[model samples]
Target: MSEPDVSKVLRLFKEEVKVINVGLEYFYKELRKQGVNAAHVIWQPKPELEKDLEDILKKIL
Candidate 1:
């Protein structure tokens, strides 16, 4: 049998994400679609994901 994908367990949980400010409005919508919250701390954004986050924030907010 093929090895199981252990990576899934290390991934983010759906409710783990926290939404705030003007973004909370649609936060739940996206979270439900992805099957995981993806969000973590509501403070500073991760440097690696900064670029993508900025793009999304600019478009949405």
Candidate 2:
């Protein structure tokens, strides 16, 4: 709820995704240790952000 907790949760999500991509079990474990909840932190698509992200992806591709 607080700023630092929100930041930590966000950071953990990124680390978890990286772990998942490389199949790093320990990193995933560490993310859980930091009290990151996947349901809470994993991004959900919003209309505006989703559009922006799609644009960015198109550019990258």
Global CA lDDT computed for model 2: 0.58
The CA lDDT of each predicted structure is: 0.59, 0.58
Writing each residue's lDDT as its tens digit, candidate 1 over 1-61 gives 9999867556746336544333353665676567754543345554675788889988998
- Give the clashing pairs for model 2: none
Query: What TM-score does prediction 1 earn?
Result: 0.21
Question: TM per model?
Answer: 0.21, 0.26
List candidate 2 segments past 4 Å from native: 1-22, 39-61
- Model 2 lDDT per residue over 1-61, tens place: 6555577778777774432313455655676777654322344455565778888989999
Q: List the residue pairs that clash in candidate 1.
A: 14-37
